[model samples]
Target chain A: MKFKAFLTDNGVSLLEKRFLPALDKMGRICHLYLTKDHAFFLHNLLNGDGVQSIAQFRKESLFEDYRISSQNDDRIAFTIDLGLLHRALRSSVSVCGHVTTATNRLQVKLVKKLTHNSQQPMPFLTFESKGYKSAVIQDVPISKPLSRVDVVELQSAIDMAQDLPQTLVQGPDLHQLQSFVDRLKHVGDLLHITITQYGDLHLQLLNTLTTLGVEFRKLPVVGVQAHVPSGDQNMTAQSRTKYAVEKGEALSVQVSLKHFAKSLQCHLTKPDCAFYGITPLASCLTVIFQFFIPGTRQTDKSISLHCRLPVLDPGSA
Target chain B: MSSSEADPDIPDLVCQLDNVQGMVDALSSVRWKRHQDSVLELSEHGIVVIVEESGCLQAKVYLKKELFVSYEYRAEGRPRFGVSLGVFVDCLNTFSVSGRSSSIEICYPGPDMQLLLKSVDTPDACIYAEIRTKVPDTISWDYNFEPAGSTPLSFTVKSAALKEAIDDLEWPGSSIQIVLQPDPPCVQFRGEGHGDLQIDFMYYANTDLLIAFQCDRLVSYRYKYKFLRATTSNMPGSVIKDNRGSKLTIGRGGMLKVQHLVSVARPSTQHPHIDSAAYQQPSRIAYIEFFVKPEVDEEPVNDA
Candidate 1:
């Protein structure tokens, strides 16, 4: 197996300042999946507990000269401590001022190091940056590459987690939602999320002594037609409205407040907007963060992050 | 069941206040514990919240009817209920958006006797909460504080300075000794334990720091430092920012009463359209009082 890549200035900033730090908040260790076309940072994908986060970036978006070769179809996957990775990235870029114009270039490669005390070799992801005045190198230890069977299982888990809900509604401002959730933390442990086809989102926190709720109305709906099952002519915009009028019921799911709050940390990336969706059977709540171009409403497809928050049993709530 | 279905003769108690932050500030001042319960008493005049700690420390927050934008009380008599102070304060905090003042409507005895709160403004979005209230148990102890002496031994000091002094003295001892001298017209707080700390406030040195001094004889009493710290620990920032005066009066039997004023004025910036004349009408304020008992074995040192 062989992997080497040179990070662009934009990629350095996004990974060092935004993506890695955000992932660090979610979990201690995250699987870094490298394929021919994309790189993914996945957290708790195989585990049944905790919030599962998948952040995908197109290879060209971050790396200029990317090369990878492996027996398992050129796909490499390994888990690394997110904190160590983030710290390495921060040190590499910060040593050189003005990343855009400085004579600093960061190159990352996978290598095995032989220690004097141990006979076996240990794998490490090394980051080497050469600045005008000094050169900084950081070595982050990583787990051994996954076997072929493990890689297949991981791919299936990623596919299963990518399933979108039938309905998706835009969420409120993240800062406002954050504060509201912080207050709810004082009240209860479980949060009931309700989303309707009519662009209404309601969050409720119920306890033995108090029932607190906040409702946002008239949010813009997204990906309604695409997610609806085929052979349904009523899935059009007008027909959807009519159907909503007929069935005024909404999709509601109960989730742990701690998990929900953990997922909201994605707001640190400063996404232009976010869309929320819940599975019909209350399996999970999906939060998709969308970034927009600086001067336009066009979506920035270079980077994307989505979280699947496991729903708690309604009866237990 | 809606209030309409209830007896029309006895209307439900509903009050609306535009200054949600002011109310939050006053309520949070007395929130010393995370799970403390506060009893609420509502009448035509206003709302009174009483919180007590171990029968040794008691606090009362008086939110007058004038502090709110509208007060509609039709209950025949005062109704009392118990609620968790932490939950109540947090619920009110949600209605107060930073830099923007919002009006909140409060109603009592929801179909199930739940206290209901709803944000009045914000058409697109609305925040609502319902808190369950239990029948209030009769207050454990009600100490009627009478002046300890003829001259009504009391001293008023800057709330910020007083809060700072008490906070600084927390590390020295478990009990704090408060001494007032009539000769030099000064008050001193001394803490003794592993070390000693004494903070003095003289009336003549800086009148602003020691706002008022009225005493005919020297009196000294010792109080639990924990209870004394509770009086100023949770004081809201607005109170300290306003530089309000906190008065500490010694009542009969060494009972110490600490009083603080919290302004519940509707920030004029939020309501630019409202005339200044209405804003100048002596901004309504909330009165908070804390009563702490002196150490049992300590005798008052009287130097007349």
Candidate 2:
């Protein structure tokens, strides 16, 4: 297996300052999955507990002169410490001043290191930056690459997690939501999230003594439209109209408040907006963080981040 | 819909407050401990929250009906309940957005007799909370606080300065002696322990600092330094920011009463509709009083 890439200036900044730091808040260690066209940072995919987060970036958006060769369809997946990776990137940028410039070059390569005391060599992701006066090189250790069967299972988990809920509603402002959730954290251990077809999102915390709730109304819907059968369009439309006259029935799921607050830390990335999705009877709630062009509403497809927060059992709360 | 509208089960009390921070400030002043329980009493005229500590210190926060934008009380008699002071204050803190003001509607006896609070002004979002309240037991002590004589010994000082003076005396002693002299028309705070520290507030020295003064004779009483510190330590920021004055009165039986006024009015611009007709009217205020019993053994000095 061989993998080498030169990071662009923008890529270094985005990874060092935004993406990696955000992932670091989610978990201590994460799997770095590299393929021909994309790279993914995944947390808690194999673990049955805790929140799972996936951050994806298009290869071209972050790397130049990228090359990879492996027996498993040119794909490489290995676990690494998020903090170490972030520190390495930060040191490289600070040391080289203007990385990727004519005189300063930054390259990331996967190599094996031989230690005097050990017979077997250990794999390391090395950051090598050269400047006019000084050169900085940092080595971050990595777990052994996953076997083919393990890679297939990991890919399946990713696909399953990517499944979208039937209904998705935009979330409230990050600052407001953060403050609200923080208050809820003090009141209860579990949070109940309710979403409706009419663009309302309700968050509630309950205890023996008090029940606290917050509702965001008329939020824009971004997912699938309410299902209406084509054959019985007229009758269904009439019935739907009647149902609309009544209050919209809401779908709710209970999740740990601690896990929910941890996922909200993605606000540090300063995403344009966040969307929430909950599938009925599902064991997790989906949160997708969308980044947009600086001044426009158009989404920046180059990067994406989403999290799956495990829902507590209905009887648990 | 207004609570006045006829319904099968009308709530015992419903009130709307425009400035949540003002209410938060009033309640937080008496929240000296993390798990203190406060008794909430509702009357047609206003609401009173009473907190006491081991029968030595008692605080009362009076939020009159005028302080609310709307008040509806239909209960036949006064209803009282007990709630955790810290939880209630922390919950109210969430309703207050820093830059903008939001009105909150408070309702009592929520189906389960819980206190219900809902944010009313925001069109896009609403925050609702229900805090469980217990049936209150009879209060520990009720000091009638009758005046010592025809002219009560009382003085008003700038809250900021008073807070500073009390805080500065922390290191000097465990007990503070307060003396009011009619001859010089000044109040003296004396702390004695490892060292002695005396702070004098002369009535005529600085009108801005010492706003009011009244004394009949030389009356001095010593109080626990910790109890006196509680009164000034948590004086809300708005009181200091608005340059309000706090009145310290020595009632009969060596009882100390500290009175503070907190404005409960949101900016007129935020409630133009309500303030349009009577914009010149002064904003309503909430009254907070802390009653502390003086040290038992030290007889107060009285010059007849």
Candidate 3:
């Protein structure tokens, strides 16, 4: 193995015709008088990221006898310390230099064989220097793996989303409960089977009279009326009339049960009936009316109902 | 050098040199070529220059001066203005010593009539006889007009004298160029003729709506002609004039025929009745007239 570098026609003209001769004649004097890093700087600029440091090149064992010249056309020739350069060429870090060495060494040898076998000079440079042959190779480092910080940040985002509300319930219990409510009407009477909701009942329940054939009504709501004065205008001059009705007639009894009491409670989530109008009954009921069934303690289910009976007859009163 | 001791021949030499210098100055003054906004070129001869005054006020003032030439002939046709150019009598002075004397009284040549009347100091009401061409025995002159009040604008002509002057006038070989100034937006033209000489009194004017008149239509060559701009007082912004202070060149005689008119009508109410009689006379027109005379048989010069 050896350190090798090949120059193109353009590179050869710049170095062999212009720079190298100046270098050979002046050497250390040239380095001192001119910019200290001429050759290294030019090589680095031309090759970009591949050239070695100037200190490394100067320390080579065969630094003194290097050959540099313009051969006929625009070709350039340069010799390097083969033994020391071979060590650098064998190293993984010196791949660029290794590639130059390998390609030029083979090219030079092929040219030699062709020239020796033929009756003419081959169309390639025949180097006479001792240290100018090595292999060339691509030189780039491998990419590194992702860092821990990135992985940690990704996992932390996932953990931060865990407390969000459930988007989907995953069980058979909800289906079973829905089926129970749908089939509740078929349950036996002894169980006092009643279907309701977690709010007020809007309809009256049927009551059976075991002793009498006639059924009476019960008021679920009370009504009270008071005279209210006009807010504006001359009410004092306006005529006012008071009278006993021409004849008292019987009035129909009806109930106005609150249909949204529990719904209001649930929506407000308050212990008091602040969201509902709780009214007292004007007539006493002969039968009890179940307003609503609170949700089951363990299952959270609710129901509502209403019942009715006759108030006392006037004669009885 | 003493003044009296100087060579007598030196003064003679200086005098001869002065004469040569004078000859050069004279040659230069005899400008055979000229360029102007309005030019009537005659080969190897002076041109008849018509300077279209730009503003309405200026044109009105210029028109009052004999800068305006009016010719009235009661043919079986409409009234119009026409102008033609003959050899300016002033030009004859150059050849007077060469044994050629005019046998006719070239009294008021076109340009002289225009210049004298325009530059004259006569009051608007006072009419002076600014003689044009008194062709010794060819044509007579006349001055006629109806005054605003009682008096009449009268013109008298001697028929016999006019006939004699007409005969003595020698046109030999000459060309005439008539510039048609149409009223701002009037393009009315009526042409009638039996053969080579057709007469048309076309209404034309400068862009100024005020300066307009009926003139003889002699446009044969198609040319792009420019007229003074009509002042657009009603246009809200600064007045926009297509040919504001610029000469319009009718492309190579192509635009010689005038058909379209661009005009700015005066506001009727403000000056109502003030100029009604003058402005609204149906066949009314205002125009400046001039003529050009080029040597006959000489080809017209193509404008460079």
lDDT of 3 at B211: 31
Q: List the per-model TM-score of the A chain.
A: 0.89, 0.90, 0.14
| Model 3 agreement with the true structure over A1-317: per-residue lDDT tens digits | 12233332323332333333322321111111001111221111112122111111121111222333232221222223222222322342232222234333311111322334668443322232223444343221111211344324333432332221111111112222223222221211111110011111111111220000001111122122222233411211101100101111112112211211111112111111111111122121111112122352232112111112122222111
TM-score of chain B of 3: 0.18
Error of 1 at B150 (Å): 4.5
Q: What TM-score does model 2 achieve against the real structure?
A: 0.87
Q: Compared with the true structure, what per-residue lDDT tens digits does model 1 show for residues A141-239?
A: 999998988889889999998888777889998988888888788888988787766676778888888888887867888655323334432232323
Candidate 1 wrongly placed segments (more than 4 Å) = A95-104, A223-248, A314-317, B1-11, B273-281, B298-304
Which sequence of candidate numbers ranks them by DockQ, best first?
1, 2, 3
How high is the TM-score of chain A in model 3?
0.14
TM-score of each: 0.91, 0.87, 0.12
How far is each candidate from the true structure, as Cα RMSD in Å?
5.0, 5.2, 47.3
| Candidate 3 error regions (>4 Å) | A1-317, B1-62, B65-266, B282-285, B294-304
Candidate 3: CAPRI quality band = incorrect
lDDT of 2 at A79: 98
> In terms of TM-score, which candidate is strongest?
1
* Best by the lDDT measure: 1
- How many clashing residue pairs, candidate 3? 48
TM-score of the second chain in each model?
0.93, 0.92, 0.18
lDDT against the true structure, per candidate, is 0.84, 0.83, 0.20
Candidate 1 lDDT for residue A77: 94
